[model samples]
Target: MADELKRRAVHASGAGLVALYLLAAQFDLGLTWDRFQLLMGLLAVGTIALEFLRLYVGLELSLYDSLTREYEQNQFAGYGYYMLSMTVAVLFFEPRVALPAMLMLAIGDPISGTVSDDSLKFVKGPRVLVTMFVVSALIAAPFLHETPLAVVAAAIGATVADGVKLRIGDYIVDDNLTIPIYAGLLATLVLEFGPV
Candidate 1:
């Protein structure tokens, strides 16, 4: 439980990136969207490099033992996927869709993780799914209030991403990669097509 709590703590810390992005934008701190996207892209590249070193070059880091799950030992860790997803969201989606989508992964996923039973494997329980949806909806509401349909769509996307564990061959698709991407795509669709 202590270890899980520590993981959750680190998971929740991803929210700081969103906060920093928002604050920088609001205050005109010189971190524009293009710059932010570039930074995220660099981070994604760095993580990929690290994963390559760890998986193929036989580089071992102590932090991996502590921060990564058993399933991640032989594969890319969640942090890499998290960075990749955030980069994808920011680069491909508008701020209105991307910000809340990032928040859904950063804030909503950690909260859902806290209530989830990892031992269940593959899929989280119904309660965890509901919690994910509600939290994701709340996180998105202030940003997407004018488009209620977008908000709901984002929530549903995040919930589905968080609740299901999809596998392709030997690799399990991490929610860290899916959550923001799914949320952003759904929200963008709603904003584009849903009634104003």
Candidate 2:
């Protein structure tokens, strides 16, 4: 439980990182969308390079836990999945969509995890669902232009994505990858099709 909480704490810290999207959205950062994509691309590449080095060269970093330390064996370490998903979300969605989508995962997932007593049913229980939706809606309201519909969709999507523990052969899909991508796509769809 302590390890899970520690991981969730690290996960929640991504909210601060997602806040930077606001600067780009408002054009305060002087970053064009293309430049933003380039930057994210660079960051993704750098992350992969470092991971490769760490896995192949036995670069032992104290920051990463045994989960990532065993990256040579585990192709999809949590941090790698995190960077990959974040980069994909940024590149795939517009800033408006990406910001709230990322926030849903960043803020809501940890909250859901923290509140759930049962690890197996974490985001699946009814109480956790309500809490996830309310917390996600509140956090996303200020940022999402299509507040009501998009927030609701994002909240639900993030919850579902977080609940998923899909495995493909040896690798398990991380929620860090699932949450933002799933929520972002759902939010985008809702914003496009659902009534405001």
Candidate 3:
């Protein structure tokens, strides 16, 4: 029970980053995409280095226990995947696409996770998917040009990607990586090519 609460707190903290980005944009804090990319890159590198140490040098950390699962014992934690994907998204896409993508990844992923927990009294599966889609769409609406279609496609794509845990041989692909890349790609493609 304590672990579940800690996990939720961590998820909420990650979701809070969406607000920081929004506030920076609103307050005109000069938070450009380039700077954001730099930030994410640094974080990604740091996470990778720490994970290496944790695996090789016997770096036993309590925080990691709260954040990671047995699947991540010899792999990068979700936070690493999150930073890496965010950096890639910022680097490959323009601000308009990347911003909404980040918002969906930051906000939508946490919402889906928090509500999907079985111990929370909610037992319906479709309800979780619907809630995830609706929340993602709302998050993307403010930034997406074709708000309805683009946001809907992004929401569906992200939710689907998040639901499926992929594996390449022995390496499990975390949703942290899939969520932003899939969501950003779908949103960008729909905005660029679908239904002008």
- Specify the highest-lDDT model's number: 1
What is the Cα-based TM-score of model 2? Answer: 0.81
Q: Candidate 3's residue-wise lDDT over 65-100, tens digit each?
A: 887866678766776777777777778877767766
* Cα lDDT over the full model 2: 0.72
| Reference-based lDDT, residue 60, model 2 | 63
lDDT of 1 by residue, 37-153 (tens): 888888889989989998999998976765688778887888888889989999999888898899899889989987877665787899899999999999999999999999999
Candidate 3 Cα errors over 4 Å, as ranges: 117-124
**Which 10-residue window in model 3 sums to the lowest lDDT?**
115-124
Count of clashing pairs, candidate 2: 0
Clash count for each candidate, listed in order shown: 0, 0, 0
Query: Candidate 2: where is the Cα deviation over 4 Å?
Result: 1-6, 24-27, 66-73, 121-123, 145-147, 169-171
Clashing pairs in 2: none
Candidate 1: give its CA RMSD in angstroms. Answer: 1.5
Score each candidate by Cα lDDT: 0.89, 0.72, 0.74
Off by over 4 Å in 1: none
What would the per-residue lDDT of candidate 2 be over residues 1-196, giving only the tens digit for each residue?
A: 5556667777777776665655665667777777777877887798788788776877767666633524335464776777778788889987777777777777787787776765653236777777777876776677674467887787777777776566789666778788779878888898788886
